[model samples]
Target: MATDRLGLYVHIPYCVRKCNYCDFCSLPNGGAQVPEAYVDRIIDEILSYSGRVSTPVDTVYFGGGTPSLLSSTQMARIVYTIRKSLNISPHSEWTLEVNPGTLTKEKVDAFFNLGFNRVSLGLQSIHENEMKTLGRIHTFDEFISSYNMLRDAGFGNISVDLMYGIPHQTLASFKKTLDTVISLSPEHISVYGLIVEEGTPFYQWRESLPLPTLDEECDMYELAGRQLAVAGYEHYEISNYARDSYRSRHNSLYWRFGEYIGVGAAAHSFFAGQRYFNTDNVDDYIASSGISVTQTPESECDLEYEYAMLGLRLKEGISLSDYESLFGHSFIDGKEQIISRLEEAGLLTLDGDRLALTEHGFYLSNSILVEIL
Candidate 1:
């Protein structure tokens, strides 16, 4: 019998150059070539999970610093190892996160042949000044070149990554970026408002930065939804929009509270009522016999809270039956008063067994979820 479906997240924590706003587990190329043993080590890690993990793979996401740093032969070897060692479903959706100036026709063709059906390109903005302020390595011209090459390489499913609220960004610039992306008609679009976190250059200079005013930021975000909807894209998730069935299956698994296996540095996984993440130290992960993993304790309340928080991210919201089945209790019974209040305030909607936020509630989701969940 076939095993249950599982999502697999593979982390490639290497970037040609780290962006100013980035805090992901990755580092600059540092003028050194990629480690020769990188392929073997990752393959070894994959094989180590063989008998330990019982589920078959439904979706595989190669997220990064920049997975495009891997050469075609290296990617092929790693992919081949995954197929050889795991029970990958025939209908699996494999996605690779790439950046501009790092991909070419041959590299993407290799990925296409290896069964990678989706590509999420990092295109933060189309304006040159914004790109420079964000410390991105490539220009809009470079993104165009990379994008065209991927299309030529027969990639039908592509997701563009965009950002707003960058220093000196304006609503007009955001529109140009949005309109340009819409013109390309990619399968998906992910737009995030910039957040300056600690330990980053942006954080240090945040006070003096000419970042968007709170009101302007809100307008930019609101405008994103309106423009994207006009372009025939479904605002499926808070930060994501898709056309037809091109929604990201791997990401959907997370929002649904489904199980997944994460391999590589700083990769987090939740499966079988437990949560864990591998060490963030790349050198340590490479040299150790066994990776140091941290198991986070999740109490019953924590799980329920997490479910509600994550489910609220989707436009479809949470299903009553599904919630009850997972937690063995009625979600409505637990939060009827709060639901009634939110509904009265026009921030929430109840469609039979489903509970989701309204279009207005989308921008206020963080506050609403904090209150309800």
Candidate 2:
């Protein structure tokens, strides 16, 4: 199943209002009113890949600006088209990314009915002030309501997104957020450290903002790992936690360097040994029927390096024997000294044939990776 399976990502570039800290491709005013023509373009793109993709799609992710903003009818049409045009497996994990205020009970039921078995809710923090600082449109109560609606609709798999290193966010406040989210007991959790990207409003106001210090941010990250582990969640990836088999299959595919096709504006894809992305402009994507902005075939060296880089993100790390089979050389062929040095530093570990980062090494992964690679 792992050999030839594919993942599908549908990007909905519509949001009620862009967050101050976000630099992702999205239109602030488009969520409230997604044009039918845009939806049709997505459908057409899916159809275009019908006969080309030989593998069965095992995972489908509807990521967004806010995918929950689509009307029930529009969502249904897209789902219908995917099933009709693609070799989607019956047991595929279909995930929809939603914002609190964007969901309703009817929409929740419709999502489940349309085969979206997993939902990733974006609720960065519960504190009203912190929410405002992040430019979120929903209140804490609204998020609770949305979660309740999803559960009431019989949706068992849910993932909540949390953020740290926020402006004026204290350790105590972040601890409370973790406590509150833990109490809800979602199937999966993702904790991300806020990055003030260059084009975002946060970047413009960076000098005046009271962001948590680097030490405090590190503390928050450590606290999350400790608390989540105690709460019976596995730190499966650098920023993701899951209970049992609840890990995000869609995301896991990417970390494995598996093939996937992305549809819609600004979506990226890796298939046929090539990597490409659609234009960010919605109108341009619609007119071109999802023409790629750029398409480049990846070299064997690129894939080997990519495999090593992405595999390192997982807690299980990369399999040296498997790497040899794929690349016709040992991953540690010429880097024995560097690997030994890192192992001595206790930053990395070689257990049997699998090479992985130690618990402490995860914190310094970027630097460790730079040194090794």
Candidate 3:
């Protein structure tokens, strides 16, 4: 097995109902039902990469339009196929994204038995009205029930998804959601502000919605960070907070610029200084002769800018040593003026050997990063 770490991401592009705010490549639950034949095609794709990428995989994440929709037998088959075909590490953190409406006791046990140690539940909000407004099938009670079931099913390393900045979301409502989440005390929490994508229904009606102001959104983010921190969760990455030893190792790989292979429809991967993505259409993905790797158009300058933008999202920020090792040059020499300006504005901090963003900086992080890049 190679010493270099790798990650495997499997995208299941099926959802019961398309959320208004979502634009990820996913089909309506009933429109494109996931058949066993589809699963076999994905397994074939996984096998194709066995000899191509020789590194040992440290993480395997089943992200989706609800990976929980798959039956235990189906999930076990996928996990088993990967284990047989790849050099999967014994202690790899295998995670599956589950929706509140889809989880069951049997499915949870099967996932645990098949070596899925981490579960990310899509409990977007604990408010029933908000859930309905967001077109979520699961009610608040159902989410709580699913959560309790996961706990009862012996899952300790769990992460819950929460959304802020909805159409009518007030600070008080957001705070209540945060308080409810804190009380549950999952090992990890991913708090995301709503982003209305171009093709989504939310975007069509965005102008009519009473969206939170930019400042209010920032306040909500900072407040959530402070509250989660107070509850013993470390605000490790942007939108991610975790208790000690429970950070999302798989996602951290993306921000840290580690290599990973993405399998299934619309999945993206970065490896060997190159980035590529599979075709987004499910039919196209299943019909393709084999694994298709489309090389992305990116320049060295583009990569550098991306590195800084992504790395800065972490609370620990970017390290000079790692930056130099990867790029074969010193960050200080090329970006002195830009860094100085950001630091002077109090948006960034330059410690001994690391550069990190301030809490205030995170709100305007994208703009600040663009300026620096």
Candidate 4:
């Protein structure tokens, strides 16, 4: 049986520059600010969790504002500490996120030598103008260079991120982006539709710009999915497409409602039937003597809703059997009427024991899920 193991996430909150559409917890580059002290604090936090839980870690992910910005030595030190502090399995998937400009051959080699088996590169688009519009500092040439360097470094498992529906992006431009991405043939590709979050530069500029309509965005999504499928990528999630054997193990943990522990500023964790987040302030996080009390765990109702939302995002949807196993009741007992209604509308399909969304339903998944849940 596959054990109900926990994954580990470490957030690196420093970035050389903040993107126009980003609202993630990150700080822009100031002066010479090294993450050494912050790494020490996180090591302490990990040690605090020792002996409190017995589950072995199967995955470790280093996500960030730009984790590649850290010196290779710094990264190695953090990885060493994590290995020492946790009961991590030898074959666990260890992933690190890298921005295009910061990935160098030396850095890539160092990360590989330190046992990072996966590297997720941020290559938002291949168009220089589009990159500029998104406030990205790297150009297409720089991204390609970084990619080649990683390949030269002998890293086999690589993932790349792309964005669609940006300002001035048309079907043709989006298709070109997809073509560029497919040509690279990454093991995994995460395509996201740009959402204008409040307080971000894109959101503030929304009034002056003509954003893509919802229908146009949906059309773009469908086109991308079709193209990716033709290239032998599985549309495993709403926004993720991966080649066989390349699906992100760490992200799958989130979609499957598995437990994970997150470290660093603004990191979130779900463990022991509880969900919580760390402080977003880097200075405060590093200054704390112990696990900061700023974390807030979720209520039981919130967890239920999260399970429904996350599971619905996957192509497999949620298993009725798994729902009963977790909640101690048949999923259909309470939602039979709703399921039947949705089935009538051709939004959901029930093939004996399995339940999933139909092709049309996936595009309107949110509305369908709200009705069912």
TM-score of each: 0.96, 0.97, 0.96, 0.94
Tell me the tens digit of each residue's lDDT in model 3 across 139-215. Answer: 88888898898888888899999988887787899999999988988999999988888999888988897788988
Backbone clashes per model, in order? 0, 0, 0, 0
Report the poorest 10 consecutive residues by lDDT, candidate 2: 289-298
lDDT of each: 0.87, 0.91, 0.86, 0.84
Put down candidate 1 lDDT per residue, 224-296, tens digits, no spaces. 8999999888999889999999999999999988888888888898866678998888888787544357899
On lDDT, the leading prediction is 2
List model 4 lDDT by residue over 254-282, tens digit each. Answer: 99898899999999988877667888888
Q: Which stretches of candidate 1 lie over 4 Å from their true place?
A: 1-3, 30-32
Worst window of 10 by summed lDDT in candidate 1: 30-39
Error of 4 at 46 (Å): 1.9
Worst-scoring 10-residue span by lDDT in model 3:
29-38
lDDT winner between candidates 3 and 4: 3
Q: Which is better, 1 or 4, measured by lDDT?
A: 1
RMSD of 2: 1.6
Candidate 3: stretches off by over 4 Å = 1-3, 31-33
The regions of model 4 sitting more than 4 angstroms off are 1-3, 30-33, 294-297
